[model samples]
Target chain A: MINLQPYENPMYFGYLLIGLLPIIIGMLYEKRFRWYETLFSFCFLVLIFDGPKLGQGIALIGYTIFEVLLTWGYVRYRTRPKGANKTSIFVLAVILSIAPLVVVKFTPLFDPQHPSIFGFLGISYLTFKVVGMIMETRDGMIKEFNILKFLQFLLFFPTISSGPIDRYRRFIKDYDRVPTKEKYLELLEKGVHYVMIGFLYKFILGYFFGTLLLPNIEKIALINGHSNVLGLSWSLVGVMYAYSMYLFFDFAGYSLFAVGISYIMGIQTPINFNKPFASWNIKEFWNRWHMTLSFWFRDYIYMRFVFFMIKHKVLKSRIAIANLGYVVLFLIMGIWHGETWYYIVYGLFHATVMILTDAWLRFKKKHPDLLPSNRFTKVMSVVLTFHVVCFSFLIFSGFLDKLWFGFR
Target chain B: MDNVRETVLEILSDLTGSDEIKANPDINLFETGLLDSMGTVQLLLELQAQLDVDAPVSEFDRTEWATPNKVVAKVESMQ
Candidate 1:
């Protein structure tokens, strides 16, 4: 009867913390109770998906079973070392693992009224994990698979909805051992701090930017829609900053909670944000912002593409290969977001910026004397990068879609 | 040995953008964030270009070739 969306409000945080009390105590005593962790994950998952959202809950269960069986089958075959793992077969398995998520994402494009039955909250994030595991297994990075461990990794409650997507090996290392009390105390200290920061970000500042101000700003931006050649206006600028702030605080706040809880459980899940706003260039920005997700993309998508291109002699130069990889990577990211013109444009925008950034960095490398390396220039770069990122977020906001369609 | 150390230092410095990078055999480049999988790719490419130590990317893991010294040894073994 107790159906709760995870971290939906301040009250949800209280409930979560209260529920985590036992785990906190267990970690303090230097004991990692795996069974207890599993039990809590299940209960909280139920709270999130039962009741009105029971359809999603059921979908999650079926989807998990499919993924686990698929991964198990792949790992068993891979472990044999002499198995004929054909590329086409492996590709089919990957597609099968992603089938549910792909349907969930694109179902509404053709028929908005009938969403896919397999759809559920966190499907995209979970698919990322499943697909990642399959690829890593194909590469022989994961030697053997255990069903329970695979399930636990996929359903790791805190990061299930959205992730600082943890790697399989990195996760196993943390889950398999209990930290010493001294180290756990350190973890606890950081955990508490992260949660406090999260409260400020999500509950306080996010409410101000998203709940209190965004709607009013949207009204103004709409009113001034046709005042410029590109339909840009001063009010539109406000929407950009407000929306970017809201996005950062809300998402980063969720990541902090996930990471904080993982720490309390002695799982040291990776951090997601690292002062993303302070980055000096687009490459550095990717390194800092939603770090786990970007790194996942880098490792699984971008890096693999580049490696494949080089190995097969698909491109002439290293630079060309990297550039092509960036385009394909960001375009896929945009598509993964949703099948919308704005999202696709947003992806192309980032790809262009990165390509330009690479060129500039190469040029700067050659002519270090031409571009002054003063604090002023550094500040200018940060400010410019910040605006560039904000403008991209504006495209991502789909305000243009609303504007062009004359939606009030 | 000296040539390998110099080659390692050159690759490490370029990737990290640190002019002061030292060729300390014990220093773990991965832990220091100077090298990751992408950097590993770069290092492998550089090694082939400079020293002709070629190996399949599938055959290597980051943890095995985590440090500069290990990387040097890996390249040497391949040769």
Candidate 2:
């Protein structure tokens, strides 16, 4: 049994202070707080008290209340005639979505262990999805929402933990239609399969490979370096391949399990992956990989950035504009991932590679006759892209210090 | 001369990487696999660039541009 003594952590009192005060102030002033804004405040209170048990309880209660309020507010707001004022709402939603990310990402600098300031559990995913929904509503891509549905969307338990990054339209449409008994059975079966897959990946594959295989291989490579550069490179590549596969299965398995559970609960969630490794190009890989997250970025972030650039005359020259747009998009992406210089570098590295690859493809298309149509180029591009992706992952693992200091 | 049909067919060929445009003038773009959402965006950009006409992206209707014939007609009307 888990120890309950930690529940008495002083942090609980801090959370009580941080969580309740703003809520009271907001209520007194009748100022609206976005769902995440309210949750963040509560998380702060929990962090102050250092009571994980109390924090968890408060988080559950707080989220339920926030969901209900947001849902009700959404319904009431939707009843008003469409107007130009939606732009302000969209902007507000964007800021609220990005706020938690900023706080959590930066918190490691102040307190690296807990990082409770940002409220890690599902806040990032929910914030992005909520922001996307607001954007979709403003863009007229989705019909106005009702309160209960909105609440359900926010606090939908299966996806609340780890998401397939559902879209508002898809979620609402599926929610409105009740699934048949047969469908429930089918979904339950799928859910079980997903749970099994998640367990296998997380416990068997990820743990075993990471603990049993990687360290020994690394040790061998370290001892024989320089004399066995090729061997070391190949081994490193193998390790990366294992890491990449582990990450995909672990995350994707969680998403699949979430979707399966939701499906069994009579909510039809969208699939998040479609054989990303089979992709022929980086663009295709992105399209097939972490589809929901990428789509969220595309719909709400990338497209918005592109439109802003176009409107502001920042995209005057083709090459300059493409590069600039990519940098901006990836920088935001980096910030979204975390506040560390490592993530920033990770984002910039991808942006640079994507831009250069795009430029090269454009050039090749323009001068088809001059370009080599050999199998070697195609093979090389795939190999190079894979290595580039692996290197980025290394930076993400926070092992740059080790790389620099030669410390094992 | 079938100017609208010819222009659309040429554009479709480029997009689908096909020499022949098998799509019917009245068929839905989605039904014919001629356009998905990404393809639709690409088509819009191409149309704006090639025809020097502004299409309000905000007002884009899937049904209105569901077919090459409808798209061509829309462009012609705009012209």
Candidate 3:
């Protein structure tokens, strides 16, 4: 028995490539070895959770069973001869599906030493998939439920840990059939390229920023600026940029691996990053950064909230409704990250900035002469957005908590 | 169908603050910065109100509804 967190090291990819070789060969011949793929996924799942993480392994199994039953029950109820899609049942299904994740998130607050038995790595990602299914089911989008396909989608080993969060419909499209020979070859090439980039981003750049530089900068900041209010220092600035780069490379790198592996298996998993730092506005930044997650929030949370407001006439002014939508969306995202003041503040901060950005955009629209849309302004906006994002990341890093309150 | 087209174009023009929506029926509203998530909501609401085409937000696939012509077609289909 061995435990290996996904994409944890370069060597892990060696093992991954070896396991995927068979699938790759099969795809080249325009065939899919479904049983072999299942076996490969099972073995990898064991390698990831069988050894020291047995508790989490057990938790994963139990969680999957519970979610499958819950989702299955919902689908049955919804499709049962002129379905009565009651809002109460839908809400209850969503809450029950997220209950384990809630417990896992809140466990530390109540008992610091023992994590919740319900806790496991990638619980949030799994919960996202489940909730998405439930919502789509409510909308009559997922009309039929098959246990095997649902299991495969939920436990797609490559992205089981963290995801570029593929949707049920999207995943099934690729899984149900093998790609054409040309398309499979193209996917294979892109998959290899993405994995190489992941190596560079995670092993080289992410290592430099996160493992080597971040700690030293943090130490200097603490030592130099502990006496100062809010512990501000030049080194703290360094920490901000370094941690932001590290965060991007590390998560983006992991996302690349997930997507690359998925592509190798003929599932065109959605990408998670797309030049996020180059974004010229907060809105654009979110659209590019950790894209799948943000898109999920946009589609599921923000859009839904806005529509709810409009439908219920919760507010008169559309601006106020949109602004409140940002608040709710960001606050939930912040709380999703953790139960910490810094995380909550990070969410609120984004919400505030989003509101302000909307105001600026509206004002610019009104007086186009005041804020000319030109190359210089575009570049400046990118620089400004970059720094704003880094500052938010600094808040997100929870280093400020350690600096001010002497705890992380 | 013509009425639906006119109504949709009117809404698109108002939401995007540009009359060019009627000129380029095949233009991608999203890529051209004409429609976004917010605009999509407004578009759906308008369609529901004016044309009685009730497409839910969850079913609004961006790709399928990207262009003005496609939007017009979709609205007509829903009718």
Candidate 4:
């Protein structure tokens, strides 16, 4: 049986307080600080304190504080009214947020013995959030920042780890004042439901599949050896299913817990999953699964790359450049996931599939009258997409080594 | 005679695999299922590529890209 005790980290309460500190600080400094600015400072301080080591913590906290202050200072120098210098602020924020990720990913080369870096808690998610906020501010979508509101927006605990990737504009508009007695009661009830579902998925379904089904199938494959080809094939397929189930249960569980907590707090965070397994194509699958992250890539990475390609006139052909952009975007995505050749290959694989699918659709469009509207095609697309995703996951899980090394 | 309209129409025709662009100037891209959110990104890229313009894709809200009229207006301004 899995141990629940490990989940109860002693620092858990401290982390919650750290998450809430920004809001409190923002409220207290309402006169001088924009609510969001105060919250940002609080978050910076918390991040510094929460660092794995004193030196690393001090450096990260100092860097973030300096960046935030520098950004605010630049805005102030412009002498523009509240939301006017949004573009400059956003540019600075993105650069600053991305700096930590770049340093961490590259640090392994310098210190191989201690490959792990310190002081980053949900840096990936924070980078996305900060970028999204800056973009929204630049677009003139958000006018004013309240410190408490800003803190609540940034450090909403549920999303701090493995986020549903909330956008700032959407979140701010959706968030209301904290709940009253009746509202709190309703939130508590819903929060309990979500927590129950999350716990069941993680403890029951995920654990059972990981412990029982995966091991049993592996054993069966080993016993049968190459003598029973059908058994081996079935075992591989079973392993894929187990992996897929584990991912869904794990992520969906986290999202449910986040949503439930937010709802009680009077925030209506958008639903993250929508039966992604039922998607009919790669395009549909992207729409359904990890919707927020996909959207982020679309908005910030893919679209920008496409625009840049068009602007530079480097490629004579638009379609060719667009296809290349997709590959580049996915490759960046792979690198973002981790520093591994497997990740790069996995990214390239998905990018190739997505590009080919898109090209096929384009071709079909040109000769539509020649094509038939058949259910078989749809079914085939769905099956192919699922396999593609599963294969990518296999690569992600570092299982291709087993295939190449003869299953020792 | 403006290539802007023709270019957009060609792109739309290619995307939807239908010659409906010539038939309707005021068709709702989303409601008619010609362009979902992904399609919108594709369309923006196509417009930038063909038109040689730098229209910020972020600024192209759904309401603005819903019809040919708005699309034409947005493209013209960017040019």
Give the per-residue lDDT of model 1 (tens digit) for A190-297: 988888888888888888999999989999988888776577888989999999999999989888888987887788899999998988888889888988888778
Model number with the top TM-score: 3
Clashes of each: 0, 9, 0, 2
Question: TM-score of chain A for candidate 2?
Answer: 0.75
lDDT of 1 at A194: 83
Order the candidates by DockQ, highest first.
3, 1, 4, 2
> Each predicted complex: what DockQ?
0.28, 0.19, 0.73, 0.25
Candidate with top lDDT is 3
Interface RMSD of each: 3.5, 4.5, 0.9, 3.6
- Preferred candidate (DockQ higher): 2 or 3: 3
DockQ of 4: 0.25
| Regions of model 3 farther than 4 Å from truth | none
The CAPRI quality class of candidate 2 comes to: incorrect
Off by over 4 Å in 1: A81-85, B1-40, B45-79
In candidate 4, what are the lDDT values of residues A1-408, reduced to their tens digit? 111111233354245445444543433332223455445445534543453444554654454564455434443434455435654555766677677667777787677666444435555776677666555555445445555555556666556656778876668765654445565556557765876787787667877776767777655544554665333566666677777777777777667766765554445666677788777667667767887788788788777667656557777776787788778878988998877777888889888887887788677767878667789876786788888788777677554445444557
List runs of model 4 lying over 4 Å from the truth. Answer: A1-67, A70-93, A115-117, A136-149, A176-196, A215-234, A369-371, A402-408, B1-33, B36-55, B60-79
Q: What is the C-alpha lDDT profile of model 3 across B1-79, one tens digit per residue? A: 6888889999999998986898888999977666778888988898889888888877888889999999988888878
Candidate 1 — what's its lDDT? 0.83
Instruction: Return the lDDT, model 4, position A203.
Output: 60
* Pairs with backbone N, CA or C atoms under 3 Å apart (clashes), candidate 2: A10-A49, A11-A48, A11-A49, A11-A50, A12-A49, A14-A49, A15-A45, A15-A46, A71-A147
